[model samples]
Target: MQDCRILITRPEPENTLSRERLHALGLASVPLPMLNIAPIKGPQEQAAIRAQIFDIDQFDYVIFVSKNAARLACDWLDACWPMLPVGVHWIGIGQGTTQTLLEEGVPALSNPGHTTEALLAWLKPAKMTNQKILIVRGAGGRPELGDKLAERGAKVSYLSLYERQKPIYTAQTFFMLPDVHLIWVTSGESLTNLTDYAEQHKPEWKCLPILTPSERVTLQAKEMGWVNARCAQGADDNSLIKATELHIGKQND
Candidate 1:
């Protein structure tokens, strides 16, 4: 484990936390920050967010797609509405999001399996007819959640709180590509960015072992020509660490 080097492709700030955790576990981590998260900075977007916050009580359920979404949305909520509206059940896509919600003073339920499909399954038992759901996420993300909720007779609205941009490559980013034994991909976009960089700069690095947060991302990595792509249990830093250690243990065995 000490000799193992894992490349973390999550966005910065978060990547720093992941690297620190890995370092604590005696494993080396190389942060390559494939994605750059920026706040949506247009007047129209700000107005839209304000309007959504104004009408927050109209939604029956509020779903946060990621911890970033939860943090941003809660920041807005804290500013606009001093007291959170009652009777609206808050849902988080995973445990990390749930933790964020809790930290933001919002009670939320999280997906036990830490996947969109799992969240959809959990919601299937609820009476969704005519229910209003507010999804807080980045500008562009999977439409599956909204589509599925709409299919179940729920009205879904999106509040795009942030924008995800592909990071411009730097010397530091490229320097870690050759020494990485495993690439920890948190999202499909991150996986794509990593492979695109590898294809252009270091073709041999494309086949490195990639540990993804979900099977969908694993398949994406495989389709992108990564030879060894595996799914971790969840998208949290701890899950990535556990998956990396397990993979390393298996390789050593």
Candidate 2:
């Protein structure tokens, strides 16, 4: 594992944590952020988020899609509602998001398994009809969550607090490609950006072993011609590390 050179494609700050964790595990990590998060700063966007926060109590379930969603939304909620409204059940997608919510003084129900399917399975017993659900996430994410909730007769509204954009690549971007043995792609967008960058600069590296957190991302990688795309058990640093270890073990075998 110490000899494994993994390329992390998460954005900065988040990438830093993953790198540190990988380093602690004796794996070398190269940060190659494929996506960048930018808060929506327009007056109209701010007004819309404020409007949603103003009616926070009306929502029956508040779902946070990621840690970023929880952190960004709560930043506004903390300012508007000093005392969070009671009885609004908070749902976090994973442990990280749940921990962020707790840090923001928002207690939430989180799926220990760390996936949308896991969260949905956990919420299946709840009465969803006539319930108003608010989803806090980055702009232009998958619609499956809201669509599925709506299918169960819940009125789902989205409060997009941030937008994801591809970062501009430089000469240093290509420098890491030679040593990258496995690429850790956290999102479908990141995978797409990585493949796009590879097609243009290092097409020969497209088939490099890749690790992903979801089956959806694994499928995306395969469609993009990645030969060894493996899905980890969950969307966490520990899960990714374990998956990488297993992949390396198989290669050794």
Candidate 3:
């Protein structure tokens, strides 16, 4: 929206592109990252991750649930495989993750929709009766996909590569956000963190409009006392921009 300052609550590196896109469209934004995507770095964890990478071929389908997962998986897989093992299907949850894998030399199938339920539907659980699926993701990622697959008699496993940690911010940072007209929250954890902080420090900010990635999350926002919560079409920048346009147009009406 023109001149409307939106708070981008994505982690660094990723938020950089979001801010750039918003600015290019004559929108103002403030970077207030809610979470940090940090790789799992302990010695035991590293070995476990390495072992998963080396044994990647055994999984009939390997799913990269996010761009973070794709990036780390490609890096680790590159170290282990001069060429990706044949007959192992690569899957990504969205365009961003699929594109990341493509750029990293892993041809992958992206889910037709942005949500786990959509991906599960696309995979056709009936046919997955005996498939081996590996979801490569950050720690504490959603287990819905794996659980559904397992319920269909498929063997499901995970290779957790990173953890989402809440970022530390001073009181001044929270105080500086009064002019932010909208907030874009990408994940459940981010929404919870933002809601918790707002409830404690800026209860009035609950009235500010906010954008989430899906209808489910938008409902979550409303339940958390957000007066004008909205959901973007998807988790991509294009979808977010379209949603913002629709919102501002409504105000102009």
Candidate 4:
């Protein structure tokens, strides 16, 4: 456990939890949040979003892409509809998103792989012709889900609740990170931003072990010159921490 400091690139309160879990396992952690999440700005956009939320029951299905989307959707839906509509099918892309909905008193279904490809596979057999589907997520993300649903003849609508942006960094503070044996990142956007940072400021990180939540992100990291990138099962803290243990320990051995 000694000298096994992991640079956690997850955002906000989540990073705090990640650090706590790493410490519990006798591993050290350094928080370096790459994504800054904020509600979608502009009054017209807010009004339009509110109108959409008020009519949530009109959609045949609602798919949450991340925990942030789930939490925000729950809050909005709870305010308008005390009892969730029964006809709508709720889908979560990953276990974490599904768990968020469940904890919010709204049950959602998701496959084990926790990737968009996995969700699309499970959704392939469903009836989508002329159906209305709402995809809840941050401002900018992969259009694959919506595009696939459209290809199936489903009318898909995106309800973006927030925006994910890279944090403003004025300094090239590579030394601020601890002796990072492994880097834990959850999303492709975060991975891309962090990879850019490494290329510009911390070139050495390219050779160190890194864990990504999905194979797509792992591939992205590798393409960006991170030679030692590995994919974890899921983005949740426990899965990341467990994978971190193996990678960091294997390196030490």
Candidate 5:
């Protein structure tokens, strides 16, 4: 029998996205969100973005780490910068990010494999010396992309557009998560939040399998007392579902 039940342990937007994917596959998915995404806005930050908007043309390349980043940057750019300069290449970290750019009418140069490693690998063979790279993302993200680009001779500028916060569980949120067969974790932050919740109510998640989007997330889940954690190669929805099915199949075998 297929494991018909699934638990999504991500932020709100991501939870809805994952649930839609599960629904497409004819599976039942429950949103047990652990993280919440909030836009970072302040007079100082707005001034910063406004000051930096005109300088975007100086950058040879721009990178968007997530859809939220892409949306926030593009929205701000449209309001301030009327014209997009030519020859500035746009790069997205993954399919979701790429789609976000496309939706916002921002054409990107490269849509490589998802993750910093793949994005950097795709850039390694290109001419990076003296290139300027602008990265739009959330706060507290890995600096691997910027660091790698800089090491490859590109000057990197980072723009923080939002922050990811651990959700303060309400009675409704608590009711949403209980006994379940599996939990899909897409990011380290989400996994950490899940672990924190599990610590308070270990029995709620003791036997559930933890499925992660990558090896890094798997390691984090394991560290958080999830012995049945496994990483899916592709971070896409289809890949995650296939990985979960295979893992469940293995258990049966």
Candidate 6:
């Protein structure tokens, strides 16, 4: 069967998961990556991470907001600290992040639901006060996680494990669009990057339907002029596939 052409807007190295999922749906995906993940520079960030390595025991909790954060933090932990310190509780924002922690031999506490809101609700009942939280994340994001934890009387310390950057577009990738039937956007950042690129090169590509991983992401796509954006009810492979099938099924009708 001739697979439906799909454009994946995630970054190159990290686009594998989405590519595999789209491939399983029998879609011919072109990895038109739009962002890259790189380490943040400067002595201040590195020095803080170095200090946090040994001060791990001081923190009452460690939270990983995303799988990438978990991976990057684990990389640093392996290099600096020989083993994950005990007595400090670990929390992941969602199932995927929790799985990453479990694989790394960390006993993590996380909500099965894949949302920051779910994670917060789960933690609220614990009533953990005066607990120091070490948050491993990227350059920055919504402050809700830390803010909520602080409201619960927790001291939150943020660590920048890596940085997400817009990918440099080339003529081969940028000008060769319009053939793709669908574009899958996993992050708002990726959507923004594609919208910017398309506007600069091929504005007509904005009419393509975008399948986003979350409602928050869907709104971003719409703001980018992909008015036909559809969101997965959940952020998982099953939900993504279901969302894609629904969208395609609608198109067929």
lDDT of 2 by residue, 41-76 (tens): 999889988998999899999999987898888899
13, model 5: CA deviation in Å? Answer: 1.9
lDDT of 5 by residue, 72-180 (tens): 8889889877777788898887777777788888887545566777788788645988888899889888988888888878888988888988888755556565456
lDDT of each: 0.87, 0.86, 0.87, 0.86, 0.78, 0.77
Look at candidate 5 and tell me the lDDT of residue 155: 81
**Candidate 6: worst 10 consecutive residues by lDDT?**
1-10
Superior candidate under lDDT, 5 versus 6: 5
Better of 4 and 5 by TM-score: 4
Compared with the true structure, model 1 gives a TM-score of 0.95
| Residue 107 in candidate 1, Cα distance off native in Å | 0.3
How many residue-pair clashes does candidate 6 contain?
A: 0
The TM-score values for the models, in the order shown, are 0.95, 0.94, 0.96, 0.94, 0.89, 0.86
Clash pairs for candidate 4: none
TM-score of 6: 0.86
> After best superposition, candidate 6 residue 176: deviation in angstroms?
2.9
Candidate 1's error at 1, in angstroms? Answer: 1.0
- Point out the higher-scoring one by lDDT: 2 or 3: 3
Shift in Å, residue 67, candidate 3: 1.1
The parts of candidate 2 lying over 4 Å away from their true place are 176-178
Candidate 5 versus truth, CA RMSD in Å, comes to 2.4
Higher-TM-score candidate among 1 and 6? Answer: 1
Specify the poorest-scoring 10-residue window by lDDT in model 1. 170-179
Cα RMSDs, all models: 1.5, 1.7, 1.3, 1.6, 2.4, 2.5
